[model samples]
Target: MSLWKNRNFLLLLGGQGVSEFGSSITYVAMPLVALTVLDASSFEVGVLTAMSSLAFLLISLPAGVVVDRSARKKLMLWSNVGRAALVGVVPLLAALDALEMVHLYVVAFFVGVLTVLFEIAYQSFVPSVVTKDQLVDANGKLSTTQSLSVVLGPPLGGGLVALMGATRVMAVDALSYLVSVVSLLLLPMREEPPAKTAGFSWDAVRRETAEGLSFVFGHPVLRKVVACTATSNFFGAMYFALEMVFFVKELNAGPLLIGLAISAGGAGGVLGGLTARRVSTRVGSARMIWVSVLGLGWTGVLVPLAGPGWGFALIAVGLFGFSLSAVLYNTAQVSYRQAVCPPELLGRVNASVRWVVWGTLPVGALVAGWLATSLGVRETLLVAGAGGWLAGLWVYFSPIRGMRDVPTTEPVTA
Candidate 1:
């Protein structure tokens, strides 16, 4: 049966679609709120961005273990509820004229922590909901909606910020989370908990965490993919750290143009998602991973080349290419991971991969702040673009470069 006709899959997509829309709004609105409302400096913006992803570094390992042991649906529900409550605080404070940068920072961090929990569980849950043959199609459909939200949300967010205020725009995000919670509640299947084992202890967690790490690093292709993704994320964070600042100060853009510029990238993501299955079929799934990056990611340089008026279009073009390649790469690689790992360890392995790859984001944001302060925004962006493109080289030199397809057999965990 087509995933479109699958009731459970449709429910999952509906919930996630709304959630992604909300997140995309926050993605553009949060920094604008800090920059325009609180009058935060470039360094402060970087810190704010760093705080959002830092939770992945701090707790993703443990989150994987928890997902493996508990009911993924329950974890997802709790995560959505927590994030909704946390985002709601922003609008409440704003209404009272009590909003502050510190408040945003706190909200961003805690929301990030919940996001880590939700995402790890979400990835692990997908395989259970669909057959192995449906993995690529399932991910492509999911990515398409996520990309579409990015395409539409940023422009709407910008308009909302202009018409109302950035703080109030967060209210929409909070409402969206409630929608996701309701969707999860309506799903027909209940996930059974993992079999009981010895009583939980710090020692057990430590061993399990190590086991996950070993499984990822022990696999030759996974380690290279991790390296490539980490490098891209590290530099991608730097590019994004200065992206809005560049639009405002360098290109002299207003809120609407800023939103539109960001949306261009989302447009690219939409194309990537829609084409991922076709690309995988023609290029070979494993080959599609590196091909996407090496062929398209270098266009990221168009951003730094952008100027005022007509030249400013270059930023959109650059963002489009980068996002397109990123979505393509992610779809292929994530499906690859899902295919190769043991079902029992999927949660841990996914978490382990996220831990290493996403860990670079906060560090990159911090570095971007420092680099922007020292080198200026445009120069820092140049560095980010060049470094991010170079990351593809890691995979190009690995065994995946020679393969037509990745091995589907379960890997023997080290």
Candidate 2:
């Protein structure tokens, strides 16, 4: 069936797309606001970022439990509302000339907390609303929206910040959340009931969490996917933390240039997501995964090699985007995981996998900062790039490389 025929998916995609665009604004605006407006140091900015992801790591498992128990729609709605309210505070404080780095940090923390909940609910809800046959298509379309948001969000944010100031740009982000909340509220489907257990107990939660972890690590397919994904995310986080430094110090690129570079990467992501299905069909899922991992990892190597000119920087950004095979890999992996996992365990499983995979980001960011400070930004890029490439080889050599497609029939329990 055509993707557009599914109204629930449409609303979900639309809301998520809008919300992501807003997030992209904050992603760009936050550091600029901290640095330019608040006159914060690199350390302070790092703290803000670290706090953001730290909340995700801390709250992920709990959020998964909550998502499993609660009405997913309500969870999504409340998440967006909470995020909007928190983001709105920034602009309001700025208008009163009372904005402080502390205020931004607090808002960032709350937003991150709510986002973890929203994401858990969203991921869990997808399989319920769409059939197994539609999983990859659903993921591809969602990835496309995300890619578009990435492309549009930075430039739009930059323009807004440039015109009305960073504070006002945050207001736009707040509005986007409100829109997302409404869209989710309008979704036609209800979430599947959570799996029933004998009773609620700490042991139950522990067992459930462990089950999810085992599913990811014990299964041959999931094991390699997780390894490749976790390793790639580690390096990706490092690149993200240090990209601004590379632009400013190594390339002498300004804010607009940074936005442009990000937009270029977004363009690549859009391309990857759009063609993911065809690529998977042509090359096979296993081969596609390997290609994307290698491509994404190698892109980092070229970052440090870009010349100190806009033309060269743009090329680097485009290549960086082109090398990002993760979007497709992630799309495929999520779909496969959803199809094979018991319906009742979806939330816990998704959350558990995400917790482990994403848990490395902060560590990677910290390492990137330290390495950049000690060895220089270029050297840091070289190291991260090399490490990422080596990490990709894990998937290349593993069982994941041999699998051709997700099982067409229901997966038998191990």
TM-score of each: 0.98, 0.93
List candidate 1 segments past 4 Å from native.
408-414
User: Per-residue CA lDDT of candidate 2, range 239-325, in tens?
Assistant: 777766666556766566667677777787788789888877887755677767675656657766777764466444634454346
- lDDT: which candidate is best? 1
The pairs that clash in candidate 1 are: none
Residue 115 miss distance in model 1 (angstroms): 0.6
TM-score of 2: 0.93
> For residues 1-414, could you state the per-residue lDDT of candidate 1 as single tens digits?
999889999999999999999989988788988999899999999999999999999999998888888889989999999999999999899899999999999999999999999999999999889987788878988998999998999999989889998888998998899999999999999776674255678888888888888999998888999999999999999988888888877788988888898899999999999998899889988999899999999989889999999898998999899999999999988988898888888899999999999999999999999999889999999999999998999999998998877456654554
- Candidate 2 colliding pairs, count: 0
